[model samples]
Target: MKLLTVLFIGLIMMGPSDPTFKVGEVAPDIALPNMNGEIVKLSSLRGQMVFIDFWASWCKPCRKENPQIVADYMKYKDEEFENGTGFTVYSISLDKKKEAWQKAISKDSLIWTTNVSDLMGWKNEAALRYKIGSLPMSYLIDGDGVIVAVNPRGDKLEKALKKNRKSESWFKSLFGY
Candidate 1:
């Protein structure tokens, strides 16, 4: 009986563990310093569907994706979503040089205000928390903090946002006043 109990307990300990992050799971809140050194928390944007993005100033693909991201933010930032009304982008940079990151932000015209990073390049605290494996990774989280989609880009990103939008009445859809 003692041996059986030890085996059972060991098996229980080795059982599958819950994932820290996945689609439909609540994204862990992240708080980091912005360009100006003020700390920003991801949970502060809970009432909006936020795109939690990870990128770096030196990443070419991330630079390429910035234009579309900016366009999407401008288009949907004020629009209503099924779980949240407005949209926002919470960008996390894996940049070792703060000046380079700030310069890239200006050059890319990424206008949303919640940008953050630990300035540790690949070892950024937020990137480790999210287990990020690649550049330009993003999570589309709903207003309630649930991740609804991952890495939706360009038209797909727009479509995903539209898909979650509250349905409009026929009158609103059919004619402009």
Candidate 2:
């Protein structure tokens, strides 16, 4: 009885571990196979901004956010915006079934982005390492591989991009116009 009480007390005292990456910290390199069976390494995209999105097919919020992500990607994928920043979205699905994952990707029209899944559900090693307690979480990584923001909403993302655009305009005005 005493040992059990002590064990319970110890467990209660221990707090949950923080996620693997944090804002301002360099994100760890990850190599995962995309939907096409192509392996993509995070380090290979060193000089571009990346959005590492953790989501699942069964997650309602993730589904709702898909369109917004698609729109943002479409807008920014073309050319280096005013701030000379190029964007890429790397979507990591937590689905355990291939059919559901593939179906969601098609339904949302998530084209031109890297989609990957281990089909391991919550047991996915990356998910566990990232300490994902919720779906639709994302990290904005800068060119240097440092995490710029975590779980930024659509509005916030737009605001950040807008600021970059404004800066670019100012640069153009000073130089050319």
Candidate 3:
């Protein structure tokens, strides 16, 4: 009886395991306000592949990567992905100041309409939900809302996007082609 009691105590002490970001897991949905004070939800982009970027206006690396993100969006926004006909980015900012966040979005020319932030900075609730430990982190989610890759940037980002392309005919095959 004492052995069983000790085992139970040890298990309790371990605490509940918090979910961490992973390639195959369903990326947690985010519902936060955009620069316009409107709420955006990640699940709303269900029919398209999405790149969920965790960034900050103060993070230089994230600022530097913004141009490439814009380029990739311009290049693939209309191209066919594995689960949809196009792609989009859902940028979640970790900025405590709304003005700074908006300025960065404008300055970077991140034209996506899905940018969101809680204005909590490093303590942003969405960041905590996703277990973000660093800036410039990203998750590539498929049309079905399952994460397919993480932090695919630069040439790697482009390659991953190209590799996931599913020809229209390929998609049609499952139905009739």
Q: How close is candidate 3 to the true structure, as a TM-score?
A: 0.82
User: Which tens-of-lDDT digit does each residue in 1-177 have in candidate 3?
Assistant: 999977754543332243366778888888998888999999999989899988888877789888999999999999888777689999999888888999999999999999999898868888888776666778898898888877876677877787778864476676774
Better of 1 and 2 by lDDT: 1
Q: After superposition, how far is residue 72 of candidate 2 from its true place, in Å?
A: 0.6
What TM-score does each of the candidates earn?
A: 0.82, 0.78, 0.82
In candidate 2, position 20 carries an lDDT of: 57
- Cα deviation at 147, candidate 1, in Å, is 0.4
- Residue 1 lDDT in candidate 2: 100
Please provide, for model 2 over 1-177, each residue's C-alpha lDDT reduced to its tens digit, 9 standing for 90 to 100.
999977644542332245457788988877777887788877777767778888888877778888988888888765454433677788888999899999999999988558888888877767787877666677878778888777765677655555445455687688974
Model 2, position 100, has a per-residue lDDT of: 96
Per-model root-mean-square deviation over C-alphas = 10.8, 7.3, 9.9
* Candidate 1 lDDT, 35-112, residue by residue in tens: 999999999999898998888888777788899889999988998777898999999999999999999999999899
In candidate 2, stretches whose alpha carbon ends up further than 4 angstroms from where it belongs are 1-20, 79-84, 164-177
Q: Which residue pairs clash in candidate 3?
A: 172-177
**Candidate-wise lDDT, in order:** 0.82, 0.74, 0.83
